[model samples]
Target: MTVSDEDLAIVAEQLGRAPRGVRAVAARCPSGHPAVVRTSPRLEDGTPFPTLYYLTCSRLNSYVSRLEGAGLMKEMTDRLATDEQLAERYRFAHESYLAERDAIEPLGTTVTAGGMPDRVKCLHVHVAHSLAAGPGVNPFGDEALEQLAQWWPSGECASKVKN
Candidate 1:
């Protein structure tokens, strides 16, 4: 997986900073812009960066932020305690995430992103995972994405950033 210079530039603008350890554009929006990126397990400086799939689109980030602001994290966390099937699926997602990251470079830690299996720490992470890994992978992320409106209809959020 290789990220083109154009994609990298767009992502940098989306993040408002230069992207580090971006291995590939894992997912793209409807308008063909980068939405999620697959990053290296460690930084170039050897720092452990466990976030494998990072969400870069500002519009998607805003939608996830809105969900976070609405206390969706707490609600999902609470549901995990009672929903055995959902919990099991989330645990699988966590394990898969760890495996993918370790395949790149072992971080020597079991801490997967988005507080998987036990909690819903960040909707952004979950949404990123869902977008990268696909549906039925991260239950919360799939649900949250389903709940949010189609954001790309307005315009490409990162279009002007590149121009």
Candidate 2:
């Protein structure tokens, strides 16, 4: 589904409140639709640090292609300040892009033009707890991890796809 500019703007605005310093960029697709490039900063106490971000351009390849065609990717790339987490996420995205490119056409499989896998989109979660429950507290909390475990399905994506 195509996201509208208003929706993207709302999403980006909401991202400003993320607990771990997350942010997003609202960009226009070639079809004049909207998408977001979300970034999460890895920081302790507001110092500049590593970060991770995902480009949610599910149908915006034409726009991205045009940007690339105009040689803007290089300029944009130069302007970005990267760190370990950002680099890691970029590596993951690049690998995924290459894999999707190689698997397309010959495999007769369908994927979004913007490179996101069809299985999942728009994942966000938050967790909060008090560091001191009382004078004497159990720092290692319970139940939270179990709850998270219950939330996700267990298994490899390949196995699920094969099934």
Candidate 3:
């Protein structure tokens, strides 16, 4: 889980700013550019950062932001109100996320990011979680991935990230 200088540069380019508390590239695009990043449980400045996995790809971020703008989060949250199995799974996902983050560095807080175990707030966080941890771990993340189209091909960054 080492983050190379080139990886940081590529991620910074993808994010359009310097990323904070980023530990490594947790998930890469098909073109091998960073899609999601694993961040420190706490930032260098001593801020408690609960978001473990962060989506970095500009294209994916834009798509997920569009999903948020389209009210998909409200619909998903509505389902959580009526779906028992899904709610249980989401709760488990939240627990797993918290446990993983705690393993890295115990923050002593139960609050995980992305509104897990209750409501869907950020599709980008969920999707980044899904990509970092893999499928079946995060139900909301999985659902968001299912809805997003294959986006890597449209914005290949091999040239920009050439070593």
The root-mean-square deviation over C-alpha atoms between each candidate and the true structure, in angstroms, is 1.5, 20.7, 1.7
- Tens digits of per-residue lDDT for model 3, 28-81: 877778889999999999999999999988878888898899999999999999
Candidate 1 Cα deviation (angstroms), residue 136: 1.0
Query: Candidate 1 on 1-163: residue-level lDDT in tens?
Result: 4689889999998999999999999998878889999999999999899999999999989888998999999999999999899899999999989999999889999998888778999999999999889898889889988888565424666674544
- The C-alpha stretches of model 1 lying farther than 4 A from their native spots are 152-154, 160-163
What's the TM for model 2? 0.21
Question: Worst 10-residue stretch by lDDT in candidate 1?
Answer: 152-161
Tens-digit lDDT track of model 2 for 130-152: 01121111111112222334432
Q: Pick the candidate with the highest lDDT.
A: 1
How high a TM-score does candidate 1 get?
A: 0.94
TM-score of 3: 0.93
Model 3, poorest ten-residue lDDT window? 151-160
Positional deviation of residue 62's Cα in model 2 after best superposition, in angstroms: 11
Residue 149 of model 2 has an lDDT of 40
Candidate 1 lDDT (Cα, 0 to 1): 0.89
Ranking by lDDT: 1, 3, 2
Stretches of candidate 2 exceeding 4 Å from the true structure: 1-75, 79-81, 105-163
Which prediction has the highest TM-score against the true structure? 1
In order, candidate lDDTs are 0.89, 0.30, 0.88
